[model samples]
Structures are given as structure tokens and as C-alpha cells.
Target: MPEGQVITVTGPRPVSALGVVDAHDHLLIDSPGMPGQGFADVALSTVEARDGVASGITTLVEMTPIGLGRNPAGLRAISKHSGLAIIAASGFHRDAHYPAGSWVYDAPVELLRDRIVTDLTRGMHPADWHDPSLPLDEARAGAIKGGASYHHISHAERRRLEAIGAASAATGAAVLVHTEIGTAAHEIVDLLEAAGATTDRIALAHLDRNPDWELHAEVAARGVTLEYDTIGRTKYHPDSVVLDLIERVAAAGHLDRIVLGLDLGARSYLRAYDGGPGMRYLMTAFVPRLRRRLGDDAVARILIANPARLYAMPVAGGAASPG
Candidate 1:
């Protein structure tokens, strides 16, 4: 298999630079069980592929292949075209979010683990992806993902948790978990730790929605990075709430254990409250303001260093330039 040009992992490659890396973002993810052309954004705009870089985001990790219905060929083409270090993912979203019995939930835990290991070691395929000639491990994917649902935890949630845990133990790929709204945060953390996964490589997404200071503190203390993904203050939680959570985490002195991503998808319309166009909160508003308030060093730790460290991507180069 031919490898694409090796750009600096963080931002675009430079002789001496550590690029700006988005710890998590869904550049291509759409509704589950749907094809790429069927997705609203993919159908409507070519902008979807390069939006992250255009928005001053240099590197991005697309959340899941299943949800986006992405094609590896298309993903590679997009990455080549955009010049962004586009890290991709394998594994399923929560059972309820997509098909109930999909790979993440219904498959026997060990099988799912093997599939994830294979994808990580190799690469993933869409429903039609069946090429015997391709190398699986060198497929250029980054992490394994699993989710807890939006409103409530389902009966089958534990199975997904166990599957994620097993996959993490089997392969050292990072785990990106979507926790249930409000109450399921600590339970997910305990589940992963109990399953013998290390806290350093695990990231718990959507913590701003729950707003539990103690849980945030505990997870951060354990060296697990918390993702405050609800960047555009539309749809779910308030902007103030999001800011409060960040402040709380910073005050707890766990600033190094935080990662930022918008969590926007191709299908989901931008909510009215979303600091529209350009993801203003992240680039225009949040980064500048946080730099002013927290100082340059703190901002770097929260936004840049923390994410690079959390993802375990290389960071030996110099400071990353603004996108």
C-alpha cells in the first residue's frame, strides 16, 4: 500500500512545528447506516471535507466510520486534498444511536475486540468494503470509539462498555467514549478502569453536559482527559455552563487533562445558539479569551499540549502556528 505524505501530526508539517490538533471532531460522520451521499452536509457542500482546516483547525480525528458511512478512498482523497492530518476511527457508536445489534453492542465482546484490533492494526471498511489486497493495520485509522446514549442509559449499554474495555486492553489504541446524559459519567470511568484499561489513554467525551465538578476532578486526577465537546453553545447546554466547567477544571489544577472539540456532525444543523459560522467559540472566542484570561502557557496546555499528549501523538517539534 502507498502511504500519503507524512505531514507533522499536530498541524501541517513544517521543518520545526507542532501542529494544532483537534482531539476530537466529526469531519465526515453523519447518521448511522447511511451512505456518504445521503448525508446532508456531504450532499450539500464540498466544504464538509475541508471545514476543519478552513476553520483554523489543522488536524482532525473523524469520530466513526459507521456513523459517517465513510469510504477509505474518499477519506484519503479528502486528507490529501485538504492537507490536514486526518486521523480516522473504527468501532460503533452507542447501540441505540445506530442499529441496536451492530458491531459495538450485539457481537460477542471478544469478536468486537478482535475487529477493533484488526481495524487499528489494519483499517476499517464500510458495508461494501471487501478488498483482500489491502493491509488492515496500516489503514491509517487512529482510535476506537463507543458511546452511551443521549437521554438514558439502555440495558445493553454495559455490553458496549465491556467491549470497549476489552478492545482497549487487547490493543493500546485510545478509547473515545460518549457518556449518557447527566448521571452516567463516573460509572463509565469506573467501568473502564475496572476493566484494566489505563486512565492515560482514555478520554471521556461530553463532560460539560453533566457538569459534575467532582466527577471531572476525579477523572482528571486519575490522568484521564475529559472532552468538553459542546463548543457551540447551541442545542444542548448553555455557554456559561460550558465555561463554568472549564473554569472548574482549571481551578482544580487539572488543566492538562482537558481536550477541546466541537462535536459537530455533517447531518446536524447548527443550532441557533451555536456561535455560528467558523465555530466562533473555539477559534474566535474561546482560544483568544482563554489565552487572555489563563495566559498563553495555560491556554497551550489546555488546547494544544493536553490534546497531543492525550492522543499520544508525536510532539517533539516546535510550537504550533495558528491555523
Candidate 2:
């Protein structure tokens, strides 16, 4: 609608109003990749969202892509009930999330691009395009989501990424690409760039999973934002590892390119579901520690300024209206 505004599930909001953002997270997601871990209850999701708000988060970027049980209407309900600005995602994940012979796997690049543009401009399909005749939900997706396999981009994944890049170029929306354990960073950037999406519009999610400061610095230098969301996943590595990576990257003059999130994408990761390190963990535990290590100004940039800039929709001349 306007420059410096982000399209939330409910409507468009200025980036300045988005305080203490969790740049990457999920409200409701059901996928075959993680059996029995999907959480779809609206009330339960609202409860978890309230926990995030109470812990100082004002906005959450719900990163559940298409064909992965994206509940746009439910997300709008949760946003209303929880008082959180929710930015839903459109586009596709890696091919692994889709069943064999699913439309997502066989759809040509044009159909995939149209679906994403429709979600961003008109509204998200209530059934995620399973039934095209179904009415569109009022909650439009504010960002595009794409994914790559472990150190590889399959034929289908590449096609989806191309669609994502095209949609992003057409709508001037930000894109969040899911990198498998942080692999294929350069390749993902190259493909999206070649497809017409600028590096500034692209963010590589879960880059912390790899935790290689040298690689991160190189990517950041290319003007691509780096999203670190493995905040409490001790199985990956201690928080110290990410903290060290951030410090190193910041020292390399790329602090502004950094953003943070908890990315609790499962039911078991929510306190409402009796899980550890729930949505509040980012603000209640990790952030205070981050502030102690890097002063308030630095933490503010990470939690506030950086995400605001990264997620804001560009004011393209022919961009689709946020209907």
C-alpha cells in the first residue's frame, strides 16, 4: 500500500509499528516431513502467540509455505486474538514436503508464480490452492517462501524458486528461502538474482545451522540478509556458537544484515503444548544474554531495525495491490 509497510495477515502495517519481531516462526503448520508434530488449533496457537507478545514480541513472520498446511484464516484469527502482527508466507517449500504427483511437483513455472502472486495481491487460498474454486481468504501473505534440498536444488525446487523470484519481482515482497542446514547459500542467491529478485529482497533462513562465520560473512557481503533462527536448538549447537558467529559477522561490517528468530515450527516447541524453550525463549532467555554481550543499540538493531528493513515491502511501480 505504502512504502515502508509490511502486509500482515490482517492488513498492511508500517514497519516502525512492528516491535521486537521474531523474523522466522510458525503459527500453524502440518507437513509430512514431520509426522504428528503439526499444530492447528486456533485457540492453542493464540495462547502461544500471547506468550510471544508477553515476552516482548510484537510481530511474528509465520514461515509456513504453501502445501504445508498454511491456515490463512486461522492465522488471521490468531492475530486478532493474540494482538500480534502476523505476516504469512506464500510460495513453496522444498519438494520433500509435497507428496509425489502432487500438483506442486508437476505444476509449471507460470502456474506456481500465479499462485504466489495471487496470495500476495488478492488473498491466500483458504485451502492453499487444493481447490481453486474455493474463495480466497482476506489474509494476504506478506512474503514469499522457497526452499532448497540439503546442499542441492532439485528440478522441482528450482522451479519453485524461480516462481518465488518472479512473484517477488512482481510484488516487491521480501523472500525467505529455507536453506537445508544452511547449505547452498550462494547457489540460492545466484538463482533468485538471475530470476530477477534482488539480493536485498532475499533472506536465507536457518543459516545458523551451518554456523560458518566465513561463509556467512561472504554471503552478507553480497547484500543478502542472513537469518539465524536456531536460537534454542541445543542439538545443533549451544547459543554461544550463534552469538560468536553474530559477533564475528558484525565485526566484518555486516551487522545490519543480521536478524534473529526462535523458529519454533512444531507443536512440541510451544509452551502451550508443554514444550521447552517456547516462543518466549527468544526474549526471556536469549535476548537478555544477547544484550549483555552486545549493547542495547546492537540488540535493538537485531531485534528491531534489521527485521523492519528486511521485511518491508518495496514500492514497485507496477506492484499488485494488497487486496
Candidate 3:
């Protein structure tokens, strides 16, 4: 809101201060139900932060949204311990991530918005959110994380999406949408925009998994940020694939709308848990390759400038106009 201001775990700071940001990633994530998908850095300790900071990221966004082990206190500790600015997520994840009889089943959209806004403006409740007796942590959220379905958004998911839109509009926080393997990205943007979230502050995550350069161009043309994570996940594809996709979108004049992150939420991904590539792989491995291929300008945009713009909140009383 202030000149070049962006939200961080340490509170507001100038965008210039947030150097080499990992646009999307997780810290202190302890999600259950995904038996095959656990990670080494569940608590996001000083050790993980040391390696991650050594690798290159100045700011790493934690994307484990509310009700799913979204540890705000842990995020603040990691940022302080690692000396890396960490931004936390508020809002909801994929529908399958929640239980059938959970709050999503009966909580009205307005209630969802209220809770999200409270977390963003005030402080986050403990990750074990089902218990009302637990106290809220002082650390606040910086962004709203929303998830869409694989191909089409389900009705339950729509409620979350609408609530995310309402919360973002009310608080001026960025709406980070998780597009499952990049499916239904356009529709996700349309839905958020229709519900009062401005396209300028909306970001779509994991689009690189889809590899549709044309689709990226189309989405970016409409004013939303494209977050192409999956940087070092070789199983998804070679790093060259993501590099090529970035180059294509850059050539199409959508570079400003492009951001980068490593959504390493699994135990197999973090080196701290004996995983292959750690959180800092982007700065340590990918950036060197990116520099050799796309040069420094590309490196700066994907790692720094773009992330700052995408994460910055709009000024209060100066609401962003819907496009």
C-alpha cells in the first residue's frame, strides 16, 4: 500500500527490500491424507531456512492455506531464523483436502470471508483450527490462497473461491489460485474476477505443469500473474521445458505477468528430509541455468520484480479497479 510495500512475515516492508522471492512455496506445512505426499521440512526449521537462504530466495511464500496445517507462528520463526522474508497464505486449498463434515460443508460464504479476513488482518488461529479453545498466533497472513478443481471448479470449491474473492477485495491481499496441473485456469480467473477480485492482483499457480504457452499468454493478457512453479521436479518434466515455456510467454510480452516459485510441499522434495532438491534449488540450480539460457533480465523478472508486484497489496482507500 505504501510506496513499493509488500507484506512479509516480519510485517510490511518495501518491495525493494524483498529480493529474489520464491513466489510460491511452503514452510511449516504438515498436511495429512496424502500418504504419498509428505515432506522433510514440515516444521520449516532453521536448517531448512539456512540452505534455502544460501540457495537464493529472500522471500518464500508459504502456501499451505488455512485449516490445513497453515502454521503462521512457524512461518514467522522461519523468516526470523533464516533471515528470509516469508509471506503466509490465508483462504482454502483443494476440496479433497477437507473432510466431508468439515466447515466447508455448512459454513456460509460470508462466514468464510470473515474468517479469512480475520486471519489476514488480525492474526492466524492455530493450525489445529477445529478446536475453538486454541489461541491465535500473532503472525498474520499476507496472501489469500484459493484452489480450483482439476478441469472444472466444483460447487464446494466455488464457495471457497467466492470467499477468497470477497476477502481479497476487502483486505487488498493477493489472491493466489492453485490451478490443478494448470487445468481450468481461464475459468478460475473469470470466476474470481466476477466475484470482485481484481485481475491485476490475482495469480495462477502451477501453470508450467500444463505447458500451454498459448494459454499462459491468454491468461496473462487478461492481467493476472502466471506462477510457473515445479522448477526442479524432474518427474513433471525437464527444467528446459519450464525455461522454454517462460521464454515463449516472455516473447509474447507477458513477462511482467510471469512469476516463479518451487511448490515443494512433499517430503521427497526437501533435502532436509533426505529429499533430492531442497527449497533453494531455484537460486542454486535453476537460476544458473536460466541465466545461461534466458539471461539476467529473465532471471530478475521471474525471481524478484514480478514477485514483488504480484504480492504487493493495494493502498487502502485506493481500491484496485476491476478489469
Q: In TM-score terms, which candidate is top?
A: 2
Q: Tell me the lDDT of model 1 at 28.
A: 50
Model 2 poorest 10 in a row by lDDT: 314-323
How far out, in Å, is residue 171 in model 3? 1.1
Across residues 1-323, which tens digit of lDDT does each residue of candidate 1 receive?
11112222222233213356666666454565444423433322235535556656666666754444655555565667766666677665666556654444455766555665555544555431234355443244556676777655565666666766776665555678877663566677677777666787688887777888778998889878888877665668656677777778889988888888776654443322222433334766567756666787877676666666555422222112211
Tens digits of per-residue lDDT, candidate 2, 1-323, equal: 12478889988888888988899999899986788999989999899999999999999999999888989999999999999999999989997788887899888998999999999988899987999999999888899999999999999999999989988888888899999999999999999998889998999999999999999999999999999999999888999999899999999999999999888888889999888689999998898888888899999999899988888887632247432
**TM-score on alpha carbons, each prediction:** 0.79, 0.97, 0.93
- Number of the top candidate by lDDT? 2
Cα distance off (Å), candidate 2, residue 174: 0.7
Residue clash pairs of candidate 3: 38-267, 39-266, 39-267, 40-267
What value does the lDDT take at residue 290 in candidate 2? 86
Tens digits of lDDT, candidate 3, 238-298: 9999989988999999988888888887767777777768887888888898898878977
Q: List RMSD in Å for every model shown.
A: 6.8, 2.0, 3.0
- In order, what lDDT does every prediction score? 0.60, 0.90, 0.80
Of candidates 3 and 1, the better by TM-score: 3
Model 1 residue 220 CA deviation (Å) reads 1.4
